[model samples]
Every structure is written in C-alpha cells, then in structure tokens.
Target chain A: MTQASPEQLAAWIQRMAAQDERAFAEFYDATSASVFGLLVRILKDRTQAEEVAQEVYLQLWRKAGSFDPERGSPWSWVVVMARSRAIDATRSDRSYGSALSDLEARPTAQPLGNPTPRPDRAADLSEQRELVQGAMESLTEPQRETIQAAFFEGWSHREIAKRTGVPLGTVKGRVRGALATLENVLRPQLGEQSMGGD
Target chain B: MEADRFQELCEEFLLSGLEGEELRAFREELDRRGAEGGRILDRTMEAMGLLALSAPPVDPPPALRERLMAEVGAGTERRGESAEGSGAGSTPTGPSLVEDAPAEPASAGAARRDPSGPGHERPDIGHSRLDRPSPADAPYPWVRSILLAAAIVAAVVLGAWNVNLQSDLSERTAALEEAQQELEAVDTLRQELATLREDLGTIVSPTGSVISLTGTETRPDARARVFVDPQTGRALILAFDLPILTAESLYQLWAIRDGEPFSVGTFTATEEGPARLELDSLDPVAGADLLAVTIEPAPGQPAPTGEMVLISGQ
Candidate 1:
C-alpha cells in the first residue's frame, strides 16, 4: 500500500482545493491504489472499478474545497468516497442481484481473493493494513462474516438475513458487536479523532 | 423516522447500505439534525473508512490516471470557456457529491458531447415539417391556411406552457432553499440537545467524580468542571469564562498521572458560554490526581508546553 501520511494527503487536498493540478496528480499517485483496491473489492470487476475510479477522482477534484479535516483524515475521506461510489454503482446496475447471489454461493473468506492480479503493485499489506487485518481477525467467525458481508459485499442487515438465512436481529447484533470490538481494539492504534472544530 | 430507528440505522447509513425510501427518510432526518447530524456522519465515516482498510491493495491501471487527467483538463477548459463566453457557468461550491453525479453514467459521456445537453431537447420541428404536406402539394387552398393557423396556435400555447414551467421551477427552487435552511437550523438544535443529554447523563451518574478546575495565576477568573467516571475514565469538561481562543490556538486538556501528562482532548472556548469537551475513554485519567487545560498552538499535542490556564485543585 502507498504510505501517504494523512497530513500529506490533507495538505494535497488543500492545494487541490486551490485548483492546483500538480497537487491533484500527486494526491492521485499516492492514494489511487488504495482507492482502486477498495473499488475492485466491492465492484468485483476491474473495468467497472476503473470507470468508477475516474468518477471518484473527478468528485475529489470538484469537492476538494469541502474536505473537512475535522470530519476525518484525508485517507478516510477518500476511502469513504470511493466505497460509497462503488457501492452506489453496484446498486444501480441491473446485474447486482445476480452478483450478490453469486457471492452468496461462494464460501465466505477473510480478505476475499481477487483472481486478476495487477503487476503494478506488490501484494504486501501496509502497517495500517496489518493492524486493521489483525483487528478483523480477532472477531468471532460469525461477527467477522457478518461484517465482511456488510462492508465488502455491501449487504445490508436485511440483505444478509435474507441471503444467509440468518435472523435479521442476529445479523444486526453481530454487526454492532463487531463494530464495537473493532473500535475498541483500533481506538488506541488509530489515535484521538477530534469530533468538533475549534 | 424515530430516534431509535435513526440510532439503529446509523451504522448502516455510514456504511452506505440504506437505499430507496429508507435512504431518503434517513437523509431527511439527518438534514433536520443540522450540525449534529454532520458530526455523527463524520465520526461514522472515519470508523467505516478504517474498516475499509482491510481491503487488499491493488494498483489501478496507469491508463486510468491519464484518462482522468484528460477529463479534468477538458472540464477545466469547458469551465474556462463558459466563464469567458457568459456568466452562466458559475462554479459550484456546495459539498453535494453523490447528487451531483450524472443520473446515468454511460449517458453522461454522450450528454457531454451534445452542446445542448443542459437544455431541454428540441421538439424535432425539422422532422415534423418534412413529414408534413407542402402548401404547393395541398389538395385544398384552405388546407394550407388551416395548417398555418394551427402552427401559430401551437407556438403560442407552447410559449405559454414554457413560461408557466419557468415560473413554477423558480418557485420550487426558492421553496427548496428555504426548506434546506430550516433543516440546517433543526440540525443545530438537535446537536445541542444531544450534547445536553450526554452532559446530563454524566452529571447524574452516581459513580462519576466532579473535579473543579480553577484559573491559574495568569488569569484568575477562568472556571471549569470535569465529571469523570472513576470506573470507565469517561470524562466530560464544561468550561466557563475561559479566555477565547485565537484561530491558530486551542485549549488542550491533560490528565496528570504520576509525573506524566496524558492528553484528554483539545477544544476551544467562548467567553459568552460554556465549552464542552468529552473524552470517550481515558483510563489513565480515572486514577490521575490532576486535570489541567492549557493553550496549545495546535491540537494532538504530546505534552503541554504552553501556558497553563486552568488546573484541578489537589
């Protein structure tokens, strides 16, 4: 994973807000891999990921001025934007139902595998990635699967219930429980997040 | 939507799972929350974003970058052209990202190519004329007159309809703006109410300790109170009459344990009202003997090196 620090990305975003093309390019170079990685995982198609990636960057460009540091780190903002757009793309597509069914048929796995390997980057996880992966691994199997379905597969609590024959309440419980566990474990590692502006 | 439902769906909303009617209702409620809703969203986004980091890294194709830059350049050129030609292409400053996306992604490119993409589609008048019988080919001389009369009437009716549509659109636009403003006000009130509720809980908790903080020698009038839960170390500070902070500076609260200081959080104060800072869990602070607030150049300071403005009594 590219090691662009939150501060560096935030600064780049600030410059991008000023319509600095160089800053935009540098920001893209530093973070595009992570953004693309998330998009591909959710969308499950490289072409579609690539297309959405363009839209994501375009959005980043146009909305750079609105990037509030008080809200989140630049990387998180980018990830959230990428994930939301990818999920929206999937939801809008007519083929999503069949894709969801196909995904449901497969055995659940941690860090779901991608068959098409891009030679441009190494497969090693970054330190942050390792930390997140460790926290994820710490979850109970059910909790992990429920969260993975929701986060990676874009399955809602109701969708997960319908697809896996799990009770709706149970699915919601697992998600909430899993999130609490992750937040507890990751809080110290993630550092203090300021919730309000000065 | 009920508050309970809002709380329940918050996680899903942060994960971007809610769709259709549910999504719309949640957004409506969120909009009504004003600033408070925004904070909830921000916090949730940060958490969800971290979880997304679990995704394995994959580098995008190099071509995507080239294509993106090209598109950006084209957009820039278009913006510049529009700016030069007319004032109609004003830059958008709002933070509405999702709504701004092209309604149909594939058709977006096609629409971009069409010069009249932003306007209503033409009625294909040329085609209609071609399909019509020419005046010279008319069986009856009065047929041409009737056709001409019909055309005039249609044009007049169409123009009237267009005027009505424009007037209705303007009214709707103004109404939407007013509703949005009202929603923002409601959101602000919601945020304050939430803070008040949390403060009340902390205050009424039987297990919490109230620590009084008084101004240091530098300024004798600053006063603040900290309600710390001894068991969980969750603390809330309500500072009153503290010096107003400059734009470049903030007040950082620190809990002294042994000889070292652990940062609780950073906040700003107003002379007019109380400023509140809440710490989720500060285990070290629960047992610590002292809590201090200091002015810092920025937030997230490792240790307080700036002037101490307020300190808890021994």
Candidate 2:
C-alpha cells in the first residue's frame, strides 16, 4: 500500500548507484524478493533462482540509469530483465530440452487460478485487468479465443494458424486489433488508474 | 507514435522476442524519454509483459543478503565522489555510508529490531539458476519461513493425533543422548540388572542339594551351565552359544524330579542365542534326578519325545 512515487523511486535507485549502503539496502529490500519470485517462476530451481535474482539486482544497481520511467515501468522492465537472465540460464541447463517440451506439451492458455492468491500479488495479475475480464467478455467469440491462444499460451503465429485453421497473417492481425480495442473500450469504463495499473 | 501503431508492434514483439538492433533501438529511445515517452513505453511494456506472466522468481540462500548488501555498498562508495547530483551521484545521501565497515558497535537490542538483517526479507542475491543446491544448503529466509510454518503445523497436528508416539520418540531421542553422555552409567546399570536377575532366580526350601549338566554328542557346538539351589528348591539355567533349531523345531527344558521324567519347560534357541530359565522352587519332597533340555516341535508335548540335547549334572 505504501507505493513509492516515480521520482522517489528514481532517487532511491540513484542513491543506490552511489554506494550509499543504506540506499543499496533500501533498494534490495524494495526489489530483491519481487525479482527472486519472478526468477523462480521461470527457472523453477532455488539455487538458480537465487543466482539469477542476484545477477538481476546487480545489473539493476550497475545500470539503474538505464531504466527510464518514460520508456517502461520499472516493474515491467525488471521483470523482463529477470526473465532474460532466467531464460538464458535455463537454456544452458540440460533440462532445457525437457522444459521446452513441457511448455509445448502444456500450453497454458489462461491466467493460473490462484485459489488463495496472496493479497500482495493480486496487484500483479495485470492492474488494468481487474476490468479486463469485462473487456474480455465484450470481445466477439472469435477475437477472444484467438487473443487468449496467442497471449496466454505463448503461441507463435504459425502455431495459432495451425490450431485455428486460419492464415498466419489473420491471426497476427486479429491479435493486434483485439488488444488495441480492448484497451480503448475498457479505458472509458475503467478510469486511468485502473487502466494505468497501481 | 499513435496508440494503434504501438499496439500493432507490441503484438508482434510479444509473439516473438525483440532482437539485435530492434531491441537495442527500443531500449535507447525509452531510456531517453519524458512523461509522453514514458506513457507510450509503459503501454508497450505492459502489453508485452502480459505474454509471459507466470514466471516464478527463485529464492536464494539466506546468506545472500549480507553478500549483496556488501557488493551494492561497495559499488556505490566507489562511484559516490564522482556521480554526485545525478541519481548515481558522487555524494552519499544520508550521511556518509562509507563511514565504517558496517554498523559494528551496535547493541543487541538494535540488532533484534535491525531491519538490516535476520527479520529482513532474507536477502538472496545472485543465487541464480547457476548456483547448485548441493553447495548452498541454506534456502532463502522467505522459503524457510514457509517451511517452518508448515513444520510447526505438522508438529501441532501430529502431536495431538498420537501423544504416545510423540512421547516415545522423545524418550528414544533422550535415551540415545543420555547413552552418548555417560557410557559408564549405561554399563553399570546393565551389570546391576544382570546381578539382580541371578539373585532373583533362587527359591528356598528345607531340602535337596546342587546339580550340574553337560552337553550331548549331537551338539558339541551347544553349551549350557545350570545350578539348582536345593535348600531353596529353585533352579537357574543359563544357556550360551546355542545353535538354532531348524525352522519347525524349538528347544525345551525338563525336570527329571524322579527317575521318571517330569515335563518341566519347553523353549527354543537361535544362532548365538543365549537364555536363562527359572524352574519353580518345588518343595523338595524326597528325590530328584537332574534337569534336561531338548529340541522339539513348536507346540511342545506334555512329555519329552524330542532328542535330549543337553543334560546338566544330576
């Protein structure tokens, strides 16, 4: 609930950059667990997750300035960086073969049902998405199905094309059109913050 | 850029990860932006971020926090004098953090409330997929907190379900620990028990005398030493180094009170099995021959029909 302002967060990151022990401690406190949680999801190994989480933070400390609030939210950027590190690490392990096969075998096509979702992480389910269900409800059957297949399943255009018997171009085009419309239609009803994310 | 264009690229970008110059240019432009650029960037970022949201972050070992803080502090201190004013500036913001090798002189009370460690969120830095669990035995504090919670709940439930089992476990553990602490105590206690058993075997009467027995030709490998306290009219039988009977058969003992056999006792022995038997202190009526042992079928008959393996002195 005690959210940091963009400027305040930026300043904290800056102080961290300066070798201020407290600031570094503060930054680690703020971001390490979130980063660790993200890495564990990807890597699924405690040892590896810990290693990647550390590297992500060190990278963040080293390149804090590289983070611009204008270009992307720090949360999303951090998620991406952590994922990149995790994916790279995962690829090198012998288990990568099995992991990819596992992903292919079970193409998850929806937000996982968290029957007892931690209150802190409910915010992570896409802030704008509280109304996304409503927006998703508004979409035509075809558009909704196609969008879920691509977005949630991590399906490629070719895969979607094969599954739906639609051309690759159409599936790709429909996905793009659907996301734009969902945001536009939902923005009017959801308000900026709801759409903007907390 | 227009929302439509951004949305279009975002879809393509999410479907296939950004690569080479495409990703490079994107990172560069976003890093140089103001509020407008930030909004555009955030929208694109959010759109792409949705494609893969199930990623679980790793939990590192508990010790990682100390190591991470040290590294972060070092990096900042190295650049503080040079990067001042800007976020990564030269000056330390809240007094000079490079003042000492950490808050060493702090008191115990302070350490307890110390958000810097322990109750801290369990710092795990760089304990990524690259690290092996074999080398890193300590899991992150958050993970440990979860497991500890589970363990406590288990202890509570299991303790309620089986009080005897819990007590038994504790007793076994305590016994093992006690034995470890004082070997002589255990030894002395064992010796005392044996002596008591020997003394307790005697039964008193006013008549009869002592007798001894030796092994038969069939079992030279078997040996036994017996003593009959005639005044007490009780007998103690100690058998050692006895060979086990075949599966269907067992060893038995007898009292030849008269020349005629009196079915006394039935028993069994195993490889290296040792046994002590106490025959009832019969009121020594007038005459008794001696004691005898035989191997027999599991359900022993009232009289001796099996082969006599040993006959002590009569």
Candidate 3:
C-alpha cells in the first residue's frame, strides 16, 4: 500500500488544522484506503466500516488542533481512532457475538488489492511492505496468532486467553514477547522515520 | 516500575489490553516520566502502526469522497453565512434565503456533477423541489416584509432555545460522567467486598483460627485481629483504631513462636483507622503462639526495631 511520508502527512495535518480544504482532501486521499482496510478487518462489515470511516475523517477535521506530532505520526493517530471507533461500534451492536465469530472465520491471507501509489514511489512502497511482511513472518505461530487476536479482534488479555484456550498469563507473555520481537526486527528496516516526530 | 515492566505494560497499553488499575498506573507513570515517557509510548505506538500497515489496503467506495466533500462544502458555507450574518447585523435576508431555498435539488445537482460517478444519495427530507412555492403564489411586498419580520423573530427565539439546549446538554453530560464514575467506584468496592468475603469464609472454616490482638501499654487504644488457617498458611490481618504514623513510619505484623518473632507483613493505615492485609502464602503458623503489631521505620525491619503497639492478649 502507498503511504505518505511523515513530513508530507504532518504538513497536510498542519494545514488541515487551519481549515485548509485542499489539504484536508489530500490527507483524506492519502490515508483513506488503509484506514478503511484496517476498519473492515476489525469490524468485518464494509457498510459499517464506511460509515465509521466518514466519522473518523470528520473527527480528524474537528479535532485537528489536538494532533501533536511529538506524540506519534498522523497516520498512527488516524488508525488508532478508526480502530477504536470500529471496536466500539462492534461492542454496541446487538450482533457483537456473531460479528466476532464472523471476524474469526474471515481468512487472513486473502489479498487486499494494492493501493495506487505515485509512479515514482511505487517501488519504495513495495519495498516497505516487503520489510513489514518479512518482519511479521518472523514471529512464531502462537505469538502471531495471539497478537492478531488482540490487534485485529480487539480482544482483551482474558478474552484472547478464552478464545485461544491459552492461559491468561501465557497469552500476555506471548503478546509482550511478540511485540518486542517485531519492534526489534522492524525498527531497522522501517528506520527512525517511522518514529513519527519531526 | 522497572524499565522492563514499563515496556511490557506499554506494549499492553498499545494493544488496548491494559485496563482499570493497570491502565491508571501506566498513565501515571507516563505522566511522571514526562517527555521521556511520552517518547517510549510513542515508539510503542509507532511500532503498532507498522503492524497496522501490514494489513493490505482496500480501496474505499468512490462515493464516500463526494459525500464527504459535499458535507464539508455545506459546513463551510454555513460557517461563512453565520460569520457574515453576525457582522452585518439583522440582515435577515441571508437567513431568509436559507429558509426559502430548496436545498435538496441543489445538493442533488452537485452530486450528479461529481466525477466520482453516481454518489450515495442521502435522503431528501426537508426541501424537495415539489415543496417549493410557485412564482404565481409569491406573497405581496408588504406580506413579504411581515413574513421576514416573523422569520427573524422565530430565528431569535430558536437561537435562544439552541443556547438553552446546549447548556442543558452540557449539564446532562456532566451528570452522566459523574454517575459513571460513582458506578465504577461501587464496582471496585463490590469486588473488594467479595474478596474479603472469600477470605473470611476461609478463615472461619474448621482449619481456621482468629487471633485478637489488643493494645500494649505503649499504645493503649490500638486493636487488631489476625485470621489464620492453621492447616494452610494463609493469613489476613484487620487492624483498627491505630494511631496514624508519619510518612517515615509503618505498622508491621509479626508472628511470635518459641520466644522469637517472624515478620508477617507491614501496612499503613488511613486516618479513619481500618486496614486489611492479606498474606496469600505465609510461613506455617501452626506452632506460632501469638501475633503482635509494632511501629517501625518505613518498609519495616526484618526484626522488630520499634515499640510494640498491639500484641495478642495484651
């Protein structure tokens, strides 16, 4: 997937904070596909995900002033908001039990189509994805599964334990261990640019 | 918390796994560490963000862009109108256009012209073209003036009502937040009570013994109880009416056996005076003859280095 550089994204966000419509449009175009994809994975419903995506952007517009680059990258901020809202929607929905079941049933390996990147940056984007995928593959099966359940399914430690039939402490340990490994593996490839501060 | 522990918790925090006391402690630690803590948290979050990027991107529905832009355009227009109206004073003309114009037809036209193809059609609820007044039915000039005046009055009243409603909403939201906090507090208390009940049940069983410790000559009014299960090493101390100590001091518990004292645990009591300490796995107290409480330096001493305030059978 194509992604904007932190500097470019931060510039768009700063302009958006000033109510610059053009900048907002650019920001939306740059981030919407990945944001929607993440939401669909979490919510497992496209229509609801679309609605929540709209709300997420609207919130970004309204709360733009609160964005601080020192905290993290703008994309991370957006993804966090989108995931949180989608998870909340799942919780409040009456069909949450079935929705959760649907999430688990969905295949993780299905290819989500490539996002269109600028012609010159296409190779760069491809390389970035490979690095991330390589790092993800390095994890042990249980560790990857535990992290996936927590991240994509929004399962708490207890819920993940119940779902996976692993002990709660073991699940926590796996998650922590997996993240530490991923951080170590990806940090060098993703580089300090991914750290998000200007 | 140690750096490793903090990093572990930060990972949990990033995954939305931390809640309740753990979440609170993580936040406090983040605040206490200030910018340095924020950087650690940011790195954790950024790492998670990379994980998110691993998800394959799917194209958003094309119509979403048109819908979003239309909404933004409308919002900007409304903001512009409001700003202009406030600056120009009682112009009532701009608001009249807003009240009189058929908005749906214009929005439909804008949607149709959108290059993104036929966009998702929002329901035209209020201002259909069919609902527009015909030119032949237009009111006389004098009647128009009166209608404008009435519209202005209605707008003023509605504006006042809107302000009142906003204030009411704020008050209601505050009340709801306060009620939620109270409910959480009650939930915590309920959990604590349940734990206490289980402890009491264990202590009252056939294997249990309750030891009452009274104040010594040094502190005449202090009192406490030690509930222990002799078969199991589990013990709980409930201390009451003990004098509050300085920050540098703590109250310690000891099990006395064969003329020697073994450290139990130490606790600080609040001014209201009751404190409960649970020892999950204690040294076997089967041969212990008595329990005692003493005031010692903060964190307490391995052996009693302070005056005995309460002892079994005073």
Q: Could you tell me every candidate's TM-score relative to the true structure?
A: 0.51, 0.36, 0.51
For lDDT, the strongest prediction is 1
For every prediction, compared with the true complex, DockQ reads 0.20, 0.10, 0.18
Better of 1 and 2 by lDDT: 1
DockQ of predicted model 1: 0.20
Error of 1 at B55 (Å): 0.6
Q: How many Å off is the CA of A163 in candidate 3?
A: 2.3
Q: Is the docking of candidate 1 incorrect, acceptable, medium or high quality?
A: incorrect
**Tens digits of per-residue lDDT for model 2, B238-271:** 6776665543455666667757765444444534
How would the candidate models be sorted by lDDT, starting from the highest? 1, 3, 2
Tens-digit lDDT string for candidate 3 (A1-198): 556766677788898777677888988888888888888888888899899988888778766766765456666677666776777777754332332222123232321111122122122333556777887887667778888888888777667765765545456556764665566565445553463321
Give the per-residue lDDT of model 3 (tens digit) for B1-314. 54444656776665654554666688677666655555566666666777777777878998998888776666667657667755543332222222334344445544333345443454445556458666568766678778889999999999999999999999999998778768766754554565656566656868787789898987778788888775645677788888767544678787889899876666767754376665544553446788888887643555788988888865
* Backbone clashes, each candidate: 2, 42, 0
- List runs of model 2 lying over 4 Å from the truth: A1-8, A90-156, A159-167, A170-198, B1-6, B18-42, B49-61, B77-314
Q: With candidate 3 superimposed using the best TM-score fit, by how many Å does residue B159's alpha carbon deviate from the native?
A: 35
Q: Which ten contiguous residues of candidate 3 chain B have the minimum total lDDT?
A: B90-99
